[model samples]
Target: MNIEIVDIVNKINVILVEEFEVDEDVIEAGKNLKDTLDLDSLDYVDLVVIIESNFGVKLVESDFANVITFQDFYNLIERKILAKQQ
Candidate 1:
């Protein structure tokens, strides 16, 4: 279970790392998505869309705004995926 979680987190990290040209090794769960990454509004939307597509979850703008860290983002995806299966 932990491994699966890490795998998804890595996928998210890969997107951030590639888009922002940041080192993936430095990205931590608690890191602020906007502050540390210096991401702008457009990037955030792109990220939200990518995450939704990645997890097969539909993300509302309000919901995406509330999500902060990478881990929080993963938790949202996890919940949505679980809900779909139930």
Candidate 2:
């Protein structure tokens, strides 16, 4: 099956849980990573590394600053993948 954007979000959630010690139960679709997910600046940096390592894409500061919700993050990954595939 083809991977949907939700799949990307789920992968990011896993990375947050595994690499940053974030609890999975607390993450929700509409939840903001910085606000609802309890991610500090350091955790956000760690998340960038996790995103790059897992998705094989680089995370830029300008790219991340606009990511407020899980959907936003998923969309960012999707765009990166598409850009790379082209």
Candidate 3:
């Protein structure tokens, strides 16, 4: 499936808001996930599960090392989804 970045962002925002109890308004594309969302290691684990369950994309530790911002998260999911298609 060809997913748009905006859709990915929206889905991610919903997950964050519902799962993490994050405010929707704070979820911007450029914001850093750790700094902006105050996500810790456990939160990351939950996020990985959520992504895998929701998007059918498995993310490893290395995939998250460089993913600091929301856009990076979106790109990671987008890449994984596209890779799954191929």
Candidate 4:
């Protein structure tokens, strides 16, 4: 499946808003996930599961480390999707 970054971002925003109860205004691309969204270790696990289920991409532990911002998360998902395509 060819996915656009904006679509991925939109889906992520929906997940955060619905699952985490995050306000849409605070979910900008540059905002820090932990600081802005209050994502803890358990939240990350849920996020991983969500991503895997929604995007059909399995994220590794190392992938979580670099995902500091919403944009970083988007990039990671995009990369994973591209890798899956290959």
List model 3 lDDT by residue over 13-70, tens digit each: 8999999998999988788889988988898899899989999988999998898889
Q: Can you give the lDDT of residue 69 in candidate 3?
A: 84
Judging by TM-score against the true structure, name the best candidate: 4
User: Of the candidates numbered 2 and 4, which has the greater TM-score value?
Assistant: 4
Q: Which candidate order results from sorting by TM-score in descending order? A: 4, 3, 2, 1
How well is each residue in 1-86 modelled by candidate 4, as lDDT tens digits? 68899999999899989999988999889988889988788998898999899999999899878888889999999999999999
The top-ranked prediction according to lDDT is: 4
Q: Best to worst by lDDT, what's the order?
A: 4, 3, 2, 1
What would the TM-score be for candidate 2 when compared with the true structure? Answer: 0.84
Every model's TM-score: 0.77, 0.84, 0.94, 0.95
Per-candidate local distance difference test: 0.74, 0.80, 0.90, 0.90
Clashing pairs in 2: none
- Which 10 residues in a row give candidate 1 its minimum summed lDDT? 1-10
Please list the residue runs of candidate 2 whose C-alpha ends up more than 4 Å from where it truly belongs after superposition: 1-3
Residue pairs in collision within model 1 = none
Clashes of each: 0, 0, 0, 0
Q: Candidate 1 regions off by >4 Å?
A: 1-3
